[model samples]
Target: MTNQNILAVDDATDRPRISVIGTGYLGATHAAAMAEMGFDVVGVDQDPRKVEALSAGRVPFFEPGLPELIEKHVATGRLRFTTDIAEATAVSDVHFICVGTPQQATSFAANLSYVEDATAAVAKNLTHPGLIVGKSTVPVGTAARLRLLVARHVPAGVGVELIWNPEFLREGKAVDDTLSPDRIVLGGASPAAEATMRELYALPIAAGAPVITCDLPTAELVKVSANAFLATKISFINAIAEVCEAAGADVSVLADALGHDVRIGRQFLNAGLGFGGGCLPKDIRALMHRSKELGAHQAAGLMQQVDEINMAQRQSVIDKTVVAAGGSVLNKRIGVLGVAFKPFTDDVRDSPALNVAAALHLRGAQVTVHDPEANGTARANFPTLSYASNPLDAAIGASALLVLTEWPELVDVSPESLGEIVENRVVIDARNCLDPERWAAAGWRVVSLGKETVVPAPAVRVAALV
Candidate 1:
């Protein structure tokens, strides 16, 4: 009654039929990617609306390249959506639990209700042998706990094995990350489970993605620890940016110089409005909470500072905006560029950009928010703030433009065009995304965090010698 035996009984085809439970950002993308990998994928969700959207070859969420992939697979009949978990379990040999582990309403701990419920649903319907893979980010001991839960709920004749395969997908680059993952980590107790995971990811493996096999706890720790490190890296640079502001040093220049050192490669060295969105902030807090529960108070203390520093970044932006508006933004129109946490996705969960816009609006500033893909979600999140159709619309008649999120369109925005629309030729690069020299050349008074305002002197007027 091993996982291999279960697969043998259920899947007669060359490729295993995969069921991805929970069709949010993670599950939907995983299902489509698995389908593209040649497995007939059934995406399961409790929400009928989401299923209908996917069934119609439309991605409910905004992810670059994911819609096309889902459409391609759905058109070819390789991918399908379902609201019935039992129906999905009946057909699939492997179930990937991609449910969300959001932060608890009253605590810093991760709420694993979705993960637990998904596990129970799949386990209850496992009439045949199946491999259950946990792709959700959970507490370190969750996989072990879920293994026991699955064992208890699985039917008498059915064989079920649990494996922890934490997903490391960034919101914007999920498709590329899945199709050609940097590395794949599989944590399982049995050889059958590991072998099955390896076989499942054979395409990515053959494409040169490294596979790391480990114990359940280690695998769970890897995901949280990676996020924690990234959060810390971001906060570390932001902390330095704070010093740079006080000491009159340029953080961008410092980061560029620091990036040259192979030991301190600058991946998360951005010193902007700080890290937010779904993963970094919540994952770090959950890690800290879990560490405290495990009696590691010192480690938790360090992460607490990281969280504090990240939060401080948003306040710093607000303070700077207030100063830019002559100590009050009351009745002043402020343009906000980019409301999504980052570019190419519409996720605004705890987005710093939206938070700043909301804060400004609360302080009586007329905030007009703009984002390439996230305006809809941002508007939903912050109804008080007015949304614009485009960057120029956001900047039109505004006193000062605030570049909050580093969308590529916002990054490459022409200051001249923006200046022509705005009442004041003032631009605040809160995200440090725009080139200060370019804005200066375009007759803008450019302001950036952690850098002195050095407007290039208007090209020296040369009087013709008659």
Candidate 2:
């Protein structure tokens, strides 16, 4: 659909009209969820390809339940995608800035250019009184600064309010999170703006999600703080995983015991290749940079180590892979399963699994990689590595296999079937998701990150089975 065909505001309903700027993962999900919440929603983006795909009821990337929901809303005329910012502002009373804040190429600071531009565009095109909500992850004080920027550009005598409403979305489970968020936060909202937001979020609010109101800085800090804490939890367990290897103890059992404590939950305690994705890695670094800028030295130091330990996990996997290959990985046919950061999504930004695969490829390993959903995205990111259609295809004629992401398919593969294909029976369980005994019984040697590999059985036994 052309910009001219975009839906105009429908004032028949008492609910506040809505517009979402920057239709990336966060924006698209928000727009669709808003539509599902019974609001007339317009999703705006500068990329025509994204707009066209979304308008055609197709999501550009993989997100569970998003494409079907977007298609449902589009068919009902409650949702539309557009490239024109002015049209979006002309049609909605509440505009959400959902742009990306990626880490800068040279610095730990986040790149706020897109957020600033989206704020400016929405502010400049306001033909009526409206609220501009920031749903992007950004440094504290960004909303206050954008408030002044919005004030300067808004039409004379036309009211515009800026508030920070940070989003907390897990990539694969975005639909459920958006529809029934754990909590809803609104920062620096005027009574009127808060009421409008309440009206906009009536569905999720009715679904038992608590709403938290705070000052702009606290609201901004909430998102990055949560990410930093989770990253710390992940790195904490991974750090223990290294010690587990040294002491020949099982990190998983230790994690389970620790998780029994009332305070320390089981979530994010998995000992594996450390956390990496579009959010955790960058958000923690951005938080650290901002903390240091504000003279908060301790937080800055803690986050720095969290980042260091997380990156070290990748090298740990590479070293283990080399050892699993019987010393040097040079000229060895290595199979890698699951390259996405985690499972059930195609996002590969700063993925630890992909990082390990690429690092091994650079070290002269003939790497073959597979992922149920991320093969296309991963291939684009690392073109030199071979892509396979399935797990068996990836493992064929391989000397060693590595399970990176905890995709269920890769975790539940038939050991006997896989053992039939590989030249050697060595398997690196980087995610520690496999049944070691089952693989060992199938005559495959299991090399996990933290757990000690059992002594190899008689060569005659391994050869006779497979």
Candidate 3:
């Protein structure tokens, strides 16, 4: 059948009415994208404020192009939001559990309470035969455990099947990732459950995104494994970056040479402040914790190193900044550019930029931060630090500047323009995104990760003999 026909049938029978639980980054984007794909989508969350904002076509957080998508679908009546889980279960035939699985406060393990609670709520309220798909990043074997928990609450003879369909959306490119994903993965117990998922992702699959179907545990492993590999790749380059720093070799040049090998392919090869934000850090730690629980201590040891290397990059920035300030930032003014974990989003969870900024602040530096999109979020997370409206504002009267997150404006900023504002001419390119030559020509001392700062020749002093 044609795509048009599929939507018509769905609307006629109300067969694929979709409900998304936990309207955070992943859930909100999925709900809006599903609505845009012509499904009647109801986004359910425990926070009434979030539901109200989403219902009014406003995205609570920043993701480029998401608010527009949400606004368009809300106007067309294809999308809505509510805090009512009962209302959601009553109307929707497919429930997507998109709740978060944050790392526990005191441990490396993932706190599965959110996932379990979301599953239990759906199971208790699933009044009709439907599919419960999990799109959250979770530990391996979580799907098998949830299946048993869900089965007990679901009514006998009512087909409420749990499926593992983990999400791989990047923060900045979430919309594109959801609409035209690199691939789709679905894990289910039976053919019927897989069939439901296939139909649900038919649009993307038709758009040339391949689908991988497997059993529950394998499916759960895919998301965490991908994150682990990416984190390892980042840390590997960073580990090499440390070597380059010690040897005075340029990591950027090394990464370029390494990129030529087709097998390596240079995606996450850039050595900088290292990987942070919601996914990589917590996911890898959770994987390590799960590996230990499963008696795979050797595997966990490697991941533990990955975590350590990632975190060490942040401290490296702190150490470099202190060195740039001549061993102390005691009452020195410092400018910081970019506080988001990465560009194009306002998520600051485990952000290296903020961590570095906070460390500097604690060291008695008057730190002024500027992020094109993350100032509000960063302010909430680190209220003691000062914030600026723009990079120039952040630079004004600062003894030194640190480029933390590589937002485009910060990357393209003219060193001359920034030089005109600061008290001293010093910059630390923590992200390795700036041009060393350009900053040096502008008469700034540029410090970069994995590269040494070159001191310019001293001006000849001619003593006049009277």
Candidate 4:
């Protein structure tokens, strides 16, 4: 009754009530950000434990600035979490579906069951007409299907209008990306739905983010296309690294020179273990699966190559080690630095570095691994592998060291110092993370992915000979 008074009296100051379904990284952030924007946000997820945790102002995962945002919003009573879909639908004027579309267990296809179920719940619970927007990365035609899904259900007086507003949030920077996005893409079945979205996103648009409107398919494609392009760029450079290795050139310099071209500006073009994480690998596979279902099998075939190239980077590193170790890791002591798929993220889904380290272990190398935040996850995934606290600890007593994930600490590690730790002087820069000249000057051997190795400097070479 008291709540009715504030909204009933001041429509001008009223932000539209919004419900965000799902409480994964994306939903949690979205719900919090909406609350930060002065909207009352009800976050819904089937995971009652997650709902409880979030309702108590706890973030399940680490993102740089998310915990503060969640705390601020939850303290204000503007954000809440629940497993109850009906209550959320009744209380909110808009619904956002932000469920995870994980890759299917046995196929390249995405298991869209979570997304479809969320949509159905929204449709069933609606007793008043409201706009239900999808903030999930879904297949192109999924928006149309969801619209039909919603229209078929809900109360007689209620109608569900579908809107597609695909989230382009990067994992580590999701909060910033959501509130201050570079651009916003909104698409739907009707002009009215698009207009409603425009109104909803007006805050960010007014703050200078471009809001682009297109068809539902285009919005969906925007997310997958961006990931695909990034994955392709990484694989492209990694492929170039393979060529550079054969030709005796440095991929770092090559990437630098080629990046000078405006069309191919330097971004995700680092020649390393290629791309891996929750998003890129899964989305690309899902897109390929969808493309085949759409009868565009030929068009989707290159993704196989893309994936093959990416996977091959891991094997290539192991092979390089095999080459360095004289064709066998039978008694090699290999230290691996960094295990996250990428740095600054705790997520280890499809982490290439971890995979490489495990493979090396399985092939008989004594693999020691280290990562700032991903160590626990890596250990959980591969308990047999040894973990060290830092770079020096990982390198100490090792026959060879490999820089797998490019953590900032590894970038600044003094090779001269590392030379003192390893039993053998060999170091492999799997992420092309080391300075060859620095290592060469430090009396240690260095190898970079997609590039040739640098032999030990004069004094170290003489010592090895002696």
The number of the candidate with the highest lDDT is: 2
| Better by TM-score, candidate 4 or 1 | 1
User: lDDT of all predictions, in order shown?
Assistant: 0.89, 0.91, 0.89, 0.83
In model 3, which regions exceed 4 Å deviation?
1-15, 456-466
Specify the poorest-scoring 10-residue window by lDDT in model 4.
1-10
User: What does candidate 3's lDDT look like per residue over 175-271, in tens digits?
Assistant: 9999989999988646666666677788988989998888888989999999999999999999999999999899999999999999997889999
Instruction: Give a tens-digit lDDT track for model 4, residues 88-135.
Output: 988887899999999999998888899899998988887666778898
- Return the clash pairs for model 1, or none: none
Model 1: per-residue Cα lDDT over 356-434, one tens digit each:
8999999899999889988888877778889889999999888888998888889998788888889877787888888
Q: After superposition, how far is residue 138 of candidate 2 from its true place, in Å?
A: 0.4
Q: Output the better candidate (2/3) by lDDT.
A: 2
Q: Write the per-residue lDDT of candidate 2 for residues 1-466, one digit (tens) a residue.
A: 0112122234534567899998999999999999998989999999999999999999999999999999999999999999999999987888999999999999999999999999999888987777889999999989878888887787776677888899999999999999999999999887777877888888889989999999999999999999999999999999998899999999889999999998998989998899999999999999999999999999999999999999999999899888888898899999999999999899999999999999999999999999999999999999999999999999998989999999998999998999899989998898889999888888988888778885346666445665
Each candidate's TM vs. the true structure? 0.96, 0.96, 0.95, 0.92
Two-way lDDT contest, 2 vs 4, winner:
2
Clashing pairs in 4: 241-450
Q: Pick the candidate with the highest TM-score.
A: 1
The model with the greater TM-score, 2 or 3, is: 2
